[model samples]
Target: MNGLSGMREENERLEGEVSRLRTELSQAAAGDGGGEKVNELLGEREAIQAKVEAMLDALAEIDPEIAAAVAG
Candidate 1:
């Protein structure tokens, strides 16, 4: 696939992962003795978020309008 398509797919996958992590984090917070798990999930979520931001930045460099729409 082309760079744009590849990036879009990666972005979607990362977004899915972030959503899943959010769910797990919620469950961990609600369950007993899950402090460690919650922290780990948070860390992972942050990393994925950073990656998403970076990808968006790259997209912006390539096409500002497309990037804006995608970011929305």
Candidate 2:
């Protein structure tokens, strides 16, 4: 019961993080900034996206329905 609750909490947290990271990535892409800065943001976004994917993978094991909702 506690473990299920914890998984739900973690799932929500990861979903929020993924949303925030995606918003940041979109904003960064929209900006007309320096090439170096854009490249840096792209790298950061890639790292964040990777983390999100990993979290979703773990979540799928704990709760496939929630994971599918998040992924979709």
* Most lDDT-accurate candidate: 1
- Residues 1-72, model 1: lDDT tens digits: 368999989988998998899899999999999999998998998899899888878888899897779778
> TM-score for all predictions?
0.81, 0.52
lDDT of each: 0.88, 0.69
Clashing pairs in 2: none
Model 2 lDDT per residue over 1-64, tens place = 2556665676577668767766766777777774566677677767766875776677778887
What does the lDDT read for residue 68 in candidate 1? 78
